[model samples]
Target: MPAYTPPLADFTFLVKDWLKIDALYQSLGLEEFDAELALEVIEQGGKFATDVVAPLNREGDEQGCKLSNGQVVTPDGFAAAYQSYVDNGWNAMLGDIEYGGQGLPYSMAVPVHEMLNSANLSWRLTTMLTESAVLAVTKHASDELKAQYLEKLVSGQWTGTMNLTEPQAGSDLSLLSTKAEPNDDGSYKITGSKIFITAGDHDWTENIVHMVLARLPDAPAGVKGISLFLVPKFLLNDNGNPGERNALAPSALEKKMGIKASPTCVMNFDGAKGWLVGEPHCGLACMFTMMNDARFQVGLEGLGASEASFQGALTYARERLQSRAPQGVQQPDDKADAIVYQPDIARMLLTQKALTEGNRALAMLYAKYMDIAHNSSDEAHDNAEAILQFLTPICKAFMTDTGLESTSLGIQIFGGHGYIREWGMEQLMRDVRIAMLYEGTNGIQSLDLIGRKLTRDRGDMLGITRNAFAELVAGMASGEAQQHASALLDEWYQTSLQVKAFSAVDAAGGACDYLAYSGYCLLGVLWYSMADCAAQGDNPVLAAGKQKTCDFYIQRLLPRTAAHKAALLESADTLLAVEGSEFDYL
Candidate 1:
């Protein structure tokens, strides 16, 4: 297994310099936080991730999780690691203080999460879902339900799962068949099966809270009838302790690629007692409160995976001897110079580094905007919310897509050795593949971006985003970086107009490409911002290195946006013209 190291320098740079989160906290009346306290938290969080959770990653992958007699048993050390995680109060880092949480800003928690994800994604999933559940219950659940469940969930003595997908209703919630019958006592009995539930059934905690979506009788048809429910694995007793077992079980587990340690279960709920959360016929809106968080965290998963892959590949390239340098025999003492001297290897490594670092900055800003949108009372809150709404799909889709690419590059760097299990390169790829598929697929995210976000209110959100990017570009010093930023902003503005026009005719055909185009341009802006920050910093080596990476990104990667733009302009007829009968080459 590859040794995992927390990228403390990169994280600190982002938090302390790039986002200036201390000022943000102060502006938001978060007087208790400062740079020192935030760094100390990050350091301790890094230690926990590095010392405890990381070692279990390969072991968990090898052992996987088991479903025995309807109970899901995670791999060895998982339960203990989880215990350590909760004992240190890491789970409550971003929760509300009223719910026994730390009430820290989301920006402060994001880096800790990134480190956790990089160390062990499977292990991270348990808490990730729990946090999302916390968000949902806090936002939409009844105050009584909150009184009963929120404290335990925020404390991490229990875990949570979002039960959305069904066997028949893949992405179409309108076709959901889950039934919720009202009881005389004002509770409901939920009866249905939900598939692809992460952390659905686990032994790490005494209880598992499931945020379920079900339909009520005598309600309108389609998604409008769906309602959110808080269903627990163990029904609460009169004293509020876990009492009788609920009528739910993990009927089976999905055995497939990636994150094997995390149980993706086929859950069966046979008249399980549950409480209604939020208003009737408004479950989809309530559930979205949680899904948005999940989507962003999933994007962080991509960033985390990419960071891990880059570290592994960089370490291997520096130590693994292969061909000599093209210019000269720099390492004549050995059989040949390390692979790091090779141009192609350097290119691959640089690509990974560029994407990882650029996305890291983007993720930080995303979290910063989230904090402002949620916590701030300033006038910027509305703009932040609009920008966040426009950027969420891009963040989730682009980051995960790049994660798959970066991990694949890790395997490619290892060559045949990468294919072997012992090298641990393949596991990263497998684990990251699910990110692209879950929390709504990248395709669906793109549709949301183009069809909904871009076109809604006649491009108001896009205007907010473009104006934000323009301000960032205005801060850049005159040179190649400034030039690149200017070009990217212009391209983004022009492309949005083009996509808006195209959507009038056919949106689906261009949605995916438009998203990719927008993502690349957005990352270009972030890279420019990083380069600008580095240029003004005191650290010579770090600044120089960042400048080089920024240049490479601008010169090499930013041009890909042009290709996506061209593709986005293509008519939908090209895709729709193909008949079902014509695809039968097999």
Candidate 2:
């Protein structure tokens, strides 16, 4: 196995050159953040990820987590690593300053998070969940709730988990059967058993806060009756420290194919004392505040896995001796020749590089808008919010799908060795598999993209995307990037019209393909812009690599859009031709 090297140079290129962090700061009227400070954060974050987190990944996977006597014990060294993370103020980076946080923009956290995920994704889950939980609390929680919980969570002395799934509910919250009754002291008694809760119980923190969803006694039926609650593992004392144990315990740990280090627990709440975080009968809206953030973070997770697998594959390709290249022996001094010289090996590596870099660019693009939506003035806010809504599902589904493809290619490049455990490529594939299933499965994301964001809004959100792409194309110098951008804009316009004509059944049938179409088009635009940026810069090698990757995306990957488009335009008659009962004929 190879070491996990942080993509520091690529992060620098994306933040400083591609995304133009300095100008973005100036435009948003943020005087505090400049390119210098951003680079510094990336540098220090890279060091921590490489030094502290990466070393624990393989061991954590091997040791996994053990449930002994009702308490979950994380793998050896996991506790020390987490303590170091908290002591170093890493968890406080993106938290609100009002609650002992540093108040940094989400854009600043993007690269740092990528490094962490690449270094150790299983270990990174707890940290990621805590940050998302903080966002939900900051946005919806009352002052009293914030004062009691925000400081501890932000400082990483406590961790947080989202409790939305029950054995019966899964993604359909309307089926939830949890009960919450009003208490005498202005709290609620929550009695529900939540399953598949990530980081539900961990020993790294002094306490755990659960953002739960349950139904009130007087609430209406279905999802409309759901309400969000804050259920703490230990009740806070008068002095603001953990006092008594709440009526909650992990009944069993879920055995899984990957991310075994991150405990997925079955939490039984026997009248657990809880408090509502948002208005009554509006739990879904409040939980979405956290879910949206989690969705984007899951996209980042995909990007990280893609990078890690690519690096591993690239390392192997450069050293593993195999048959000679078709043309001739590229390395005559070796026993045969490095596989990196072979055309097929080169192609796989190039595809991985293109997808990984393009996905990083796309994620930063989303993060930029996230900062704008949160901090900008009225007009900017509306536009940014629209873009965020439009991109959320695409980012989650497309990135992970393509990311899975990239990692699988990594395995293919390694041949039989890739399937072996010590090579580590297989583990990367296993871990990344969960991203597509969780945080609203990729299929669910596609439905949200087409049904809610596109057709429901009558293409208003897509029009926002079109205008941005047009403006991007118009400003570029006449070249391949210019041509690619114009072509994508034209295809997107035609495709949107076809999408508008989709019937309900047809839209559902083609949602995944339509999402892929949109994601490919979006990446085309991003790659062109990135290529243009590199061409005008001083680094010739980097510039050449960027241009070649852009070309590869155009020739090899962009063509995938046509097939997706065909699927999107096709009628759902054939899809419905087969009855649901036939699916289980085997």
Candidate 3:
């Protein structure tokens, strides 16, 4: 296994060079976040990840989580590590100050989260769920709810979970059978089984707060009927101390393919006492407050996995002596040259770096927008929030998909050693694979992107991004690489408009299917502008690397957008034509 090292140089490039982190810092009102501070935090983050968390990655995976005497125990050393996290105040970095939190901006926490994910994804999942739960409680839960659960959750003393899916309802909320019958006491009795609940039960915490989605007895059907509830593992008294188990327990922990160290349990909510957060039948909206954040977190997770795999594989390639380069008479004195001598290996490594780094920049930029959306609450902040909404699915879907690709490529670069469990490359592959599936599958992400995001307003988001790109390009039309720049800018504008046209009048109908085929185009458009920013940079090395990556993207990656469009233009029947029963055997 390779030592986990944060890509500090590349982080600097993305922040200071590419996205102009100074401006973002000012935008988020963090006047003190200068280069020194940013570098210091990143360095400290690297040390914590490498020294404290990385050592636990393998041990956690091997120890997994255990159920003994009706209590779920985390892997050895997890309790200490989690306490270290709490005592150090890492959990409060992205939270609000009013709720026993530090109130540091998310721009700082995003990379920290990235390091944790790369160091130990299973351990990181626990933190990820905790963050999401806190955000949800902060946004919608009443002041009373906050007073009870906020401090402990913010301090990472007791973790949190979201209970959404059930055996009867995976993605379709209309099919949900979970019943929330109201009591005269203004609370409710939640009776349902929620599946795939991450961190559902763990000894790392004193109690678990589950943000459950269920339906009231008199509520309307479908999504409109859903309501959010705060269901705790133990009943809390007026002082917020755990009183007793509230009819919720881990019926069984899922034996998963990856992230086995984090318990994904089938939680049985058998007449659990619950407190409703926000209004009745408004649960989905409130959950989105968290899901959107979780979706972006998934993107960061994917980037971290890809970055880790690349670093490990790159180190292995540099050390392992293999066959010489394609050209003959290479390394005549030695047994063979290192794999680094091979251009293809370099190409793979560079491509992985390009994607991983680009995704990092994108994720941080989105996090910056999140801070603006939540804290600023102005007109410009509102627009940025909408843009963030449109980009969220793409970020979540593309990063994870590319992550799996990059991890697989890293494995291929190492040959049989990559597949071996000892080298840890295989674990990266397995772990990264889950991001593509969780936080709504990539297919679901695409459907949401087109059906909900674009079609609802007929190119509303597309228009915003296109107009911004054009305005930027227009400003730089006469600057360096003007010819390529001017032409691509026009193409981007045209592509945006064309995709807008792809949405039907009842745009939300089957265009979602079309989006599955053209999701890559949206990603390309975003990356095109990003690469353009870096390509037009002042630094020699970074500017050249950005230009090359953009060139590689245009030459090899952008062509996929064409296939995506063509597939979109394919009849809707291309997808619906396949009967579910017909494919059951396959």
Each candidate's root-mean-square deviation in Å? 1.2, 1.2, 2.9
Residue 44 CA displacement from its true place in model 3, Å = 1.6
Give one clash count per candidate, in the order shown.
0, 0, 0
Put down candidate 1 lDDT per residue, 1-23, tens digits, no spaces.
67889998888788887777788
Model 1 is weakest, by summed lDDT over 10 consecutive residues, at 498-507
Model 2: CA > 4 A from native: 580-586
* Candidate 2: residue pairs that collide: none
**Model 2 TM:** 0.98
Write candidate 2's Cα lDDT for 204-231 as tens digits.
9889999999999998999999999999
In model 1, the clashing pairs are none
Off by over 4 Å in 3: 328-330, 468-493, 503-543, 577-586
TM-score against truth, every candidate: 0.98, 0.98, 0.92
**What's the residue-level lDDT of 115 in candidate 2?**
89
